[model samples]
Target: MNQEPTAQEPILRIDGLSKSFGPVRAVDNVSLDIQRNEFFALLGPSGCGKTTLLRMLAGFETPGSGRILLDGTDIAPLSPEKRPLNLMFQSYALFPHMTIRKNLSYGLEMERLAKTEINHRVDEIMAVTDLTPFAERKPEQLSGGQKQRVALARSLIKRPKVLLLDEPLGALDKKLRERMQLELKRLQHEVGITFIIVTHDQEEALVMADRMAILKDGRLLQCGAPEEIYEHPADRFVANFIGVMNFISGVVTPNGSFEADGLSVPMPGAAAGPATLAIRPESIAVSMNGGGIAGSLVDAAYHGLDRVLHVKIAACETPLQVRVPAHTSADLGIGSPIHLGIDPDRCRLFPD
Candidate 1:
C-alpha cells in the first residue's frame, strides 16, 4: 500500500483533458493529479486511450480540450522538446549501432552540453541503472534487460522533472518483466522523479504503481492507491478490470439484507433494490462438509502456489471461482460436495 499524498501538493495535474479522432473519442474528459515521487500508472485494456493520454502529456498528441499543468504552470501549449519531461517508448528505440554510453549521452549531446558534463551525467545514470558494466556494449550485443537499463539510463541522464513510460517492460520475458517491475519502482524512489506509466497489464500496474488510474473506453473510471482500487472498486467495470471478481446478482431485502437465489446475507445501508455482490476468489473459503453456502465442485486448476476451484451452486448462473492454497483441496475432486464461506463485510454491493 502507498501512503496518502493528501497533505502534499500535486506536481502534475490533468484538468478536463480530451481528444478525438474522426468518429472515435480516444480520450474523454479525464482529470487527475499525480504527486511528486509517486509511481502512477494509467491502467486499462487495449484501446482504452491510456496511450493517448500519455502521448498528450508528452506533447506527442495534442488534446482537443483541457489543460496539463506541471509545477502549477499549464504545459498544454508547450512543445515536447520544451517541456521538462521525457517519454520512454515500449520499443526503447535505442540506436542499434550506438554503444550504451553513447546512447545514454545522446540527448545531452543533442542539447549541446559540454562533453565533460555529458560524460559525467552519463556515468552517473549508468551507475544508477546498473548499466556501468554494459556501457561499452551495443544494443544488438546486450540482453533484453540490459538494453532496457540502457534505455532507462538514457532517459534519466537528462534529469527530466517527470518520466513517462509506455509499457516500459513489455518486451521482456515473463520472469524478467516481473523482475523489472520492482526495479522500476526502486529506480523511481531513488531518482525521486514522478513516473507516470501507461500499461494495459493489470498485474504490472498493481505491482509497480504506488497509485493508479483506471481507464475504460476513453473514460476515467477510478483513481487511487493500488490496494484501494483492488479492494474497493467504485463500479462494475472497475471491479471487473482490476482483478478477478465474482459477481452475484441479488436484491436488497426490506430487512436490510441481500437475497440471491436461496441465500441471504446482511447488507446494511443498502436500499431495497436490485444489486450485484462482488467478491474476490481468494476471499471465498471452501470446506468439504459444511459452511456458509452449499455448492458442488465442478473443476479445479492447480496453479503453483494456489488452486482455483470452480464451484457450481444454485445461487448464480455461472460457477463461482474460489482460490485456496495449492493441494489444500487435493482430496476433493469434481462433483464433490463443498461449502463456501463468505465474509459479508468483504463483499461489495453495487446497484444493478
Candidate 2:
C-alpha cells in the first residue's frame, strides 16, 4: 500500500516558483524545501527577489508560475486570510492607536474567536515575549525593541503553521539588531514554529538560520547550513557573499594541480584551466620572522581580539589579507617585510 510520507516531509516546499512584473522577473524558477520548525533564512542582496518570494508565500503577491506547497498541499490559490500563515513586516507594523494587548488581540478579534480565548492567547503571548508590563502601552510608548516584540507577539498569537518575517529587526540599532537575532532564534525554538525570514544581511542570516537559501538575480544560488556554505562555497559568488574571502588569481596545471602566487595549491576538484584560489583571512599564517611566502606589509588593522594584516606579494597583484591574534603581532609598520604561511590544502579553487 502506498503511504503518505507525512513524518519526514518538509513543512513548506517551493517548487519552481517564479514571478515577473511586466518586464522584470522578480523571482525565477526557485525551488527549496523548509523542514518543520526550522529557522530558515532567505538571504540575498536588495532587488534579489527574497522579499518578493516572501510576499508570494504570504499570499500578498501572485506567482507567475510554480507551486507553493504547505504541508504537501498547494496554497497558491488560497487568499491571505485563508492560508495558515502570517507575515511580519520590516516596519513592525503595529497599530499606533491600539495598545500592545489590543494590537496582539486584533487578529483573533477579527477571526471572531471567543473573547476568553483571545484574552488567554494575548496574555500568554505577552508573557512569552516579555511584553506583559507594557501590555497597556501603545506602540508609540514602547521602545524600538519592545515594539518589535509587540509586533512579533501579534504575528505569533495566531499560531500559524509558518511565520514569515521580512527584515524584522532592520530598524533597530546595530547592537539591538544583533541582540534581537539571538532573541528571534530562541523564540522560534520556544514556540516550535517554522520561521522563514528574508534579509540582505549575511551576518544575520548566518547567525540566525538553521539553514539558508541564497538568491541572486531572481535565481536560486545555493542552500545549506551556514558553516557548510562558509567552509565550502559552491561557487565564486557564494564565496564572496557570505564572508570576507581572499581571492588570488591562479591556474590549474596540465597535471591536474593548481598554483597561486607561485605557490602550489592542491585543489583536487579543479580541472586544468584558469582559476581563482580562495582562502579565508584566518587560514593564512603571518609572521615577522619571515619563513614562508615573503611579502611586504601594506596595511594592518587591529580589531580587538584579532588583527588583519594586508600583504603585497610579488607574484600577486592584489593585497592579501591575513588574520592573526592581536597578541602575536609585533609593532610592524607599513612596507615592512613579512612572511605568510599558506597551506595548499586550505585553499579553494574556482574557475574563472
Candidate 3:
C-alpha cells in the first residue's frame, strides 16, 4: 500500500462572509483563505470594510451570512473568547491602571492558567518583545513604542493559532513605526503563527505582509504577493491606488503598439480600440540630444532622492513626467528642449 502525503490545511477559511448595518453592506460577500504560518494583510482605504472584515474574523462582530472555519471547524458562531485567536486592537487597548506584567498575564488569568505557566509565558514573550525592563510600568508610564510591545506581548502570550492586528502600530511615530515593522516581522517568524493585519497604510502592508489583498468598496480588488500587485495591477484603479503613474490615452495601432498625440510607443500586451497606457514615472528616459519623443520642459521638482521633470510633448495634450537623478537638476532648465523614451516592454495598456 502506498502512503498518502499529509495535507496541510489552511489555518482559517472564510466562505461567503457578509455583514450589513441596516441597508449598507459593510462586508460584501467576502471569502478568503489564510494559510498556516502565512503573514497576510487586508489593505484598503478608510471605510473600505477591511477593518470590519477583520472584526468579524475576530468574532467581535458576527457575520449575518456564511461561515468561518478555523482548522476545518465552523467558528462563525463561536464567541471571541471561545475561538483560538487573539486580536490586538488599534489603540492597543491596554488598561491604564495595569502594569505591563499584569496586562500580559490578564489573558492567562482569564483562562485560569497556573501561575508558573503564566509567568513562564510572560517571561518568554517579554524577552522576545524586549519588554522585560518595563514589566512593572503601567500603560501611562510607558512610551508609545513600549506600550505597543506590551499589547503585542499580551496577545502572543496566549499562543493563539492565529493573530489578528488592527492598525497595531498607528500609535507610534514614523521612526518607531518603521522600526517596529521589522521587529514585528521578526516576532511573527519567531513565533511561527499566522498573522492577519488590517491597515489603510499601503507602505505598511507592502513592507510586512508576505501576501496582501486590496479591498475597495467592500470588495477584493486584487490578491497576490507584493511584487505581483505592484508589477501587474488588475486595472487602472489598482494601478493608481497602489503607486504613482503617468497615464497617456492612445489608440491601439495595427502594429500592436499604441499612439497618442506626438508619442508612439510599443504596448506590452494586446488591447484594441481606445486605450490608456500606464507607465511609472521612473520608467521614463530623458535625454538632451536627438532621441525619443521631443518635448519642451514645462516644470521640474527636486525631491532630494530624485528629480522629476514635467515635459509637454508636441503630439500629446497631457504633460509627461520623467524622473531623473537629482544631479541632473543643475543641467536642465525650464523651457529647455528634451527627448523622452521608455522601453517597449515597460508600457502597460488598459481598455478605456
lDDT of each: 0.91, 0.91, 0.87
Give lDDT tens digits, candidate 1, residues 327-348. 7887987998889988898999
Error of 1 at 48 (Å): 0.5
Sorted on TM-score, highest at the top, how do the candidates line up?
Answer: 2, 1, 3
Using alpha carbons, what is the TM-score of model 2?
0.96
What is the RMSD of candidate 2?
Answer: 1.5
Q: After the best TM-score superposition of candidate 3, give how far the Cα of residue 99 lies from its true spot, in angstroms.
A: 1.5
**Candidate ranking (lDDT, best to worst):** 1, 2, 3
The candidate that achieves the highest TM-score relative to the unseen native structure: 2
Clashes of 3: 2
Q: Estimate TM-scores for all models.
A: 0.95, 0.96, 0.93
Worst 10-residue lDDT window, candidate 2: 260-269
Instruction: Evaluate model 3: give its lDDT.
Output: 0.87
On TM-score, who's better, 2 or 3?
A: 2
Q: Write one digit per residue (lDDT tens) for candidate 2, span 85-120.
A: 999989988999888889999999989999999999
lDDT of 3 by residue, 89-188 (tens): 9999999888899999999999999999999989988998889999888899988888888888899999999999999888889999999999899989
